[model samples]
Target: MIIESTWHKSSYSRAETNCLEAAYMTTGGAVVRDTQNRSLGYLEFSAMEWSAFLVEVKSCDL
Candidate 1:
């Protein structure tokens, strides 16, 4: 099967010019890319790894 992803950015950064965009994979993982450099391609993460990364990000103050 073929799946397509829709890239989106955080609502908090909607007014910002520089930010990152992300899309979800059908396999339960995610893909991320820089808004300013789409030509550079993106980074893909496995489902497990993505979940861990999100947990860490939420735990941080940043």
Candidate 2:
């Protein structure tokens, strides 16, 4: 049930099995989901927002 979008694992995740996975939406948005369940609902973020969020995450502020 996995939709193909070139998902890349999160570098910050260190889980043994389940980690974070992300892909691009058709509308140019970002889709983030748990790797453990591809059928689960994903969280979508705008390009600008995703970029800011990443910065926050990288800075350990999130």
> Which residue runs of candidate 2 sit more than 4 Å off their true CA positions?
1-5, 15-18, 26-28
Candidate 1 lDDT (Cα, 0 to 1): 0.79
For candidate 1, write residues 1-62 as lDDT tens digits. 11266788855455458678888888998888888788998898988998998898899944
Off by over 4 Å in 1: 1-4, 11-17
For model 2, the local distance difference test gives: 0.78
Measured by C-alpha RMSD in angstroms, how accurate is candidate 1? Answer: 2.5
TM-score of 2: 0.68
Which residue pairs clash within candidate 2? none
